[model samples]
Target: MYPADLVKPMREELSVVGFKELHTSTEVDQAIKQKGTTLVVVNSVCGCAAANARPGARMSLDNEKTPDHLVTVFAGVDKDATDTARNHMVPFPPSSPSMALFKDGELVHMLERHHIEGRPADMIAQNLKQAYEQYC
Candidate 1:
């Protein structure tokens, strides 16, 4: 597990933008199962997460249509929560710094790590925005 001090700022990057942090399996399950569209960000301490994923997620919210709930689970930090979130993302292998969108508790869209790494933040945001337009 990562020391809390090491991840506080990283967690704040999303928290400051209104993404609720899910630190336990139950919290993750509850957040995803809530009514309306929910966006789940499996956050990480990797370069792509800092350079692309988090920023892209924040940028995506600028859209007129957005998910009803925004939540995140920190990989390498919140083990149970991250694992639970990954279980919901089945069919796709687990990847850090990933994003998933769910409508009425069903997975609707997903952006895996490969989709974020080496990509510009705006391009990732545009991809998510497109998903939001359709699923949100």
Candidate 2:
């Protein structure tokens, strides 16, 4: 597990913008099962996450249509929570620095690690905005 001090700022990068950090499996389950659309981010300390995924997710929220709930699970830190969140994202395999959209408890959209890595934040934001337009 990453040191809490080391990950704190990374965690706050989203939490300060309204993303709830899920540290337990129960928290993950409860967040996902909530009504309306939820955006779940499998956060990581990778460069891609720092350069793109997080910025994109924050940017995506500027849209007129946004997920009702925003939550995140840290891959190397919140192991149980991340595992449970990955379970909810079945068939996609677990990947940090990934994003998923769920509407009414059903998975509707996903951005795997490959989708986030090497992409500009704007592109990722636009991709998520499109998903929000369709599924949010």
Candidate 3:
């Protein structure tokens, strides 16, 4: 895991935008079980994450139909939490810097690394906005 100091700003990238950070498996489980739309970001230290995913997620929240819950689990720093979060994404392979949208505890939409990589932040935001329109 990256040192807390190095990853602090990365964590802040989302927390600053109001995303609650899940640092434990129990926290991941409880957050996803909430009775409303929830956006779970699988945050990471990858270049795409810093340059695209975090920015995109922040921008996507500006949409009219934002999720009721916004949270994140850092992939490398919070391994247990990240693994538990991925468990909620069964059938979908794990991917760092990914996104999962759960509606009343059920997985609804997912944006994997392949989807985030090579995509501009605005485009990623647009994709998320579309998902928000359909599911949030």
lDDT of 2 by residue, 2-101 (tens): 9999999999999999999999999989999999999999999999999999999999999999999999999999999999999999999999899999
Error of 2 at 94 (Å): 0.8
The lDDT of model 3 is 0.95
What ranking of all candidate models by lDDT puts the best one first?
Answer: 1, 2, 3
Clashes of each: 0, 0, 0
Q: Could you tell me every candidate's TM-score relative to the true structure?
A: 0.99, 0.99, 0.98
CA RMSD of each candidate after superposition: 0.5, 0.5, 0.6
Please give, for residues 65-89, the per-residue lDDT of candidate 3 as tens digits. 9999999999889999999999999
Q: How high is the CA lDDT of each candidate model?
A: 0.97, 0.96, 0.95
Model 2 stretches with alpha carbons more than 4 Å out: none
Q: Which ten residues in a row have the lowest lDDT in candidate 3?
A: 1-10
Model 3: CA > 4 A from native = none
The number of clashing residue pairs in model 1 is 0
